[model samples]
Target: MYSRIGLTGDVMLGRLVDQYHQQRPVVAVWGDLLDQLRALDGLFINLECCLSNRGEPWQRTQRAFHFRADPDWAVPALERAGVDCCALANNHILDFEEEALRDTLDHLDARNIAYAGAGRTRAEAFEPALVTVNELDVAFVSFTDNTPEYAATETSPGTAYVEIDIGDEETRAAVQETLNRAREHDPDLVIASLHWGPNMVEEPPDTFQKFGRWLIDEGVDIIHGHSAHIFQGIEVYRGRPILYDTGDFVDDYAVDERLRNDRSFLFEVVVSPTGDLSELRLQPTEIHDRSVHEADDEAAKWSRGRMRDLSTPFGTSFERDGEQLVVDFNS
Candidate 1:
C-alpha cells in the first residue's frame, strides 16, 4: 500500500482570506486545486497565523506584522479544504500571544484537526501529531528556527523552536533530543516540518542544508521546510525527500515582483508502507485573488526553469508532465 501526502507552505487564512470570506466560502479560493487536494491520503500545511479573536499583540516591541483570524471563519475554511494536519511551528503562530495560541489549539481540536509544534507546554510543543492513513502511521513534527521569543517554555504556550545559528550547540542538542523522542513513536513515516531560513532568498544557507541532512540521519523520512516565500531546491538524501522550502501556498500579502514569491508549488510525495519513497511530483501553483490556482503557461515555464536552475546543483531535475512538474529522482 502507498500513501499519497499533499504538502504546502505557509497558509495564512487571516487578513485577505478573512476579508474574502465575507464574499464567499474560503474553499472557493482553492479554485481547481480543491479536487486534487481532496484525493490525497493526507494534506499538511503550515498554519502561519493564529486563529483567535482574543489576546493582545506582543507589545514589548513593535512587530512589522501580526496575523489572526476569527475561529468562526478559519475553522470552516480549513474543514472545507479537507486539511488533515497543520504544522503550528512557525514564527507567527503566537502573533496574538498565549491566549490566542491556546484558542487556536482548542479550535483545531474541536474540529478534529491535528496540529504539531506549538502547545501549552514544552513537551506538548515537541510531541508529534500522528494520524493513520491507508493503514500507515504518519507522524508530523514541527519546529521553527526563526523567532526564539515565540518558543514554548516549561509553562508558557508557544511554538517549538530550533535555533538557526549553526554554532549554537545548546539549541542544536535540544532539536536533536526532540527528534530522538519523536522517533521513539516508531511511526511508518516521520515528517520534520521546519519553519526556517530567510524570506525571498532563492538558495538556502549551508547550515540549513546540513540541518536537514541531520534530521534525515536521525530518521526523519521527510524535511518540509518553509519561510522562504519562493520555492527552493529539492534534495533527496538517501532516498528520503527534503523540500528545502515550499514557498507561500496561500496568502493575501502584497507580492514583490522581483522575488516572484507568488510562484509556488503543491508538493506531493508518495511513500510505500515500508517507508520508502516511490514518487515525487509538483503541481505548479500561483496565488490569485486570495486563492490558489494552477499556474498559467507563462508562469509555469518560468517556475519550471527556476526549479531546474535551483535543483541542478543537487543532481535533481524535473520533467514537465502536462501542467505539473515531476522530479527525476532516478536521474
Candidate 2:
C-alpha cells in the first residue's frame, strides 16, 4: 500500500471554542476520523492557536486574542483522536507569551505529541521536526508571518519567521539553520509548513510565489502554506505540488456563513520510500458548522470543477481580482 499522509490547514483548541454549547458534539465528529485513519501512519495539522493556562499578558496591546484551555479536557480530546503532529508556526502561537508557550510545549511533550515551529532559542526554533513511518524519515519545518516581536532569537524563545532585510541578520540566519538541518537529515522528504499572507486572498502575490520557488530550490520536497484561512489553489511546480493555502482545517469559525459553505479539500499526499511525492489526491469536501465533511457525489463534481479553474493560472499565470478573468502572466 502507498503511504497515506493527511495535511490540514489550521486548528485552534482553546477556551473560547470549548465554551460553545456543541464542542463535545464537534469532538464526536473528529473522533470517528481518528479511529478510521489512525493506522494510516501520519497526520499533520497547523496548530494555529496556542493553548495554555498560564502567564501574564506579555504585550500591552489593547486588543488581542489568546486561546486558553482548561488543560484537563483539551489534550485528551485531541490525542484520543490520534493527531500525531502539530505545526506551531502560526501567528497565534505566541498570543499567550513565552511562559504560556512553554507550558503548551510542555504539555505536548508530556503527551508524546510531536510539534514544530516555535522554540526556546534560535537552534530550537529552526530545527527540523521528524516523523518516522514505516522506516522512512520525514522532516517538517514551520514559519509564520503573524509573530511581531516574538520571533526566534539566539537567546530567547519564539516562533521561526522569515526576514527579508540585511539588517535583520538574525532571521536570515534562522533560515540557514533550517537549511543546514534539511541537508543533515536528507530525509525521505522535507516539508516547509509556512503560515503566510493575508487571511482570504484567492491566491499568492508575486513575492509569495518567488519565496515558494526559492525554498523549493533550497532542497525542500514540499511547500505547504496556510494562514489564508480560506482555500486558495494548488500548483504543480517542477514536479512538486505547492498548496498555497489549505484553509482552516478545524476550529469554531463556523459562524461565517460564507466560509462555512465554501468547497474545501483535504490534501492527501502519497510518498515513496525515496521521498518522491508520486501521487496527489484531493479529497473534496464541504464546510459545515465550521468543520469539514466528505462531499457527496454532486458536491464532489462541483468542487472538482472549481479547483480546475483555480489551478489554471498557477505557473506564472494569475488572474486579476474582481468580476472578470484577466490573465496577467503566461501559464
Candidate 3:
C-alpha cells in the first residue's frame, strides 16, 4: 500500500503468430515500456497471457483466442518496467494448458513479483495477494467473467472468475466473500481487477454497471477491468472509481478488426488516504514492435480526445499530455 496507489491495466505478453519473434524480437520491444514505467510505486496490470519455456505450438479454439509468452523475456520485462504485481485473472492465462500455467507460477515466484486472482488451490485462487509498498499494505484480487470453458481448479492455476456472469447470485456471493476477505486483511487499499466485456464492444453490459456499484458499496477501493481490447467508459459511484476496459497494454499484436482503428489507453491511478481517488490517468500507446508506443504531438491529443469521449458517460474526464491521457474523475 502506497500513499497513492498507481494502477494500470492489461499487459498481454504476446508474440503475434505473423510477427513471430525474429530479428527485432518481442523481448527487445518491451525495453521502452520498462524504461517508461520503472519508477511508479505499487504498479499493477492484468497478466494477460501464460509464460512458458516449453516449445509448445500455438493452440486455439474455434473462436480462436490464445496467447503465450516466453517466460525468459516476459518476467524480466515486467521487472525492468518496475511492475510489482500482476492480476492473473484474464482469458489467456491458461493458453498453453496446465503445465504452462504451472510454469508461469514458478516463473512469477522466481521474479518475486506478487500475483493474485488464480492459483494452484481453491483457497489460493480465492485469495488476494497482499503487497506492502513503503510499509503500506495493499491487497489485489483479479477475475474474469468472460472467457469460456476455463475455471480455476484446486490443483491448477487460472483467472478468478465471477462463476456464471455478473448479477448471478453465485457470482455476487463469491465477489462478496472475496471482498470480505480483503477487508479482513485490513489493506490500506484494495484493487479489484477484472477481465470482462465483449471483445470489440465499447459499452459494458448493464449487469457490469450494477456490479461495479455493488462492489463500491461493499467497500472495494478500486474496480479496474479489461478484455474488450479497447477503451470503455469510467464510472464513479459513491466516490469510488471503476475503469471498465483499458485496451491492450502490451501485446505483440491482435488481429481484431476493431483494434486497428480503436482508440485505447493504459490508465495510471493514484488513490490517496481516506479512500479518495486523487489521480485517474493514462498514457495513449500505439501497438508496435510487439509492444506499445507513445504517439507524437498531434496524434497524442487526437487519441486523448477519443478516449475522453468514450469515458464521458461515466463522468470521468481525460486530457492529452504529450502522449499521455491524463484523467481526473474527482475534478
- Across 1-331, the per-residue lDDT of candidate 3 in tens digits comes to 3254555556776657223443455346554555556556668888887878563533545437667777766677677666778888777777777678778888988989888877776567678888886666788888777664456766655567675355588888778788788889888777888888667777888778887777777778788878777767777776667887776666655445634433355567766655456766676666665566665555556667766677788777655555666656566
lDDT of each: 0.85, 0.68, 0.69
lDDT of 2 at 209: 79
TM-score of 3: 0.87
Indicate which candidate wins on TM-score.
1
Error of 3 at 250 (Å): 1.6
Candidate 3, residue 152: the lDDT equals: 78
lDDT of 2 by residue, 75-121 (tens): 76567656777888777776778888888788888988888888888
Candidate 1 lDDT over 164-233, as tens digits, reads 6546897677777776776677788888898997778889899888888888877888899999888899
Measured over all alpha carbons after superposition, the RMSD of each candidate to the real structure, in angstroms, is 1.5, 5.7, 3.0
> What lDDT is obtained when candidate 1 is compared to the true structure?
0.85
User: In model 2, where do residues sit more than 4 Å from their true spots?
Assistant: 21-32, 164-173, 254-263, 286-291, 296-302, 315-331
Residue 279 CA displacement from its true place in model 3, Å: 1.9
Q: Ten residues in a row with the worst lDDT in model 2?
A: 321-330
* Location of the lowest summed lDDT over 10 successive residues in candidate 1: 322-331
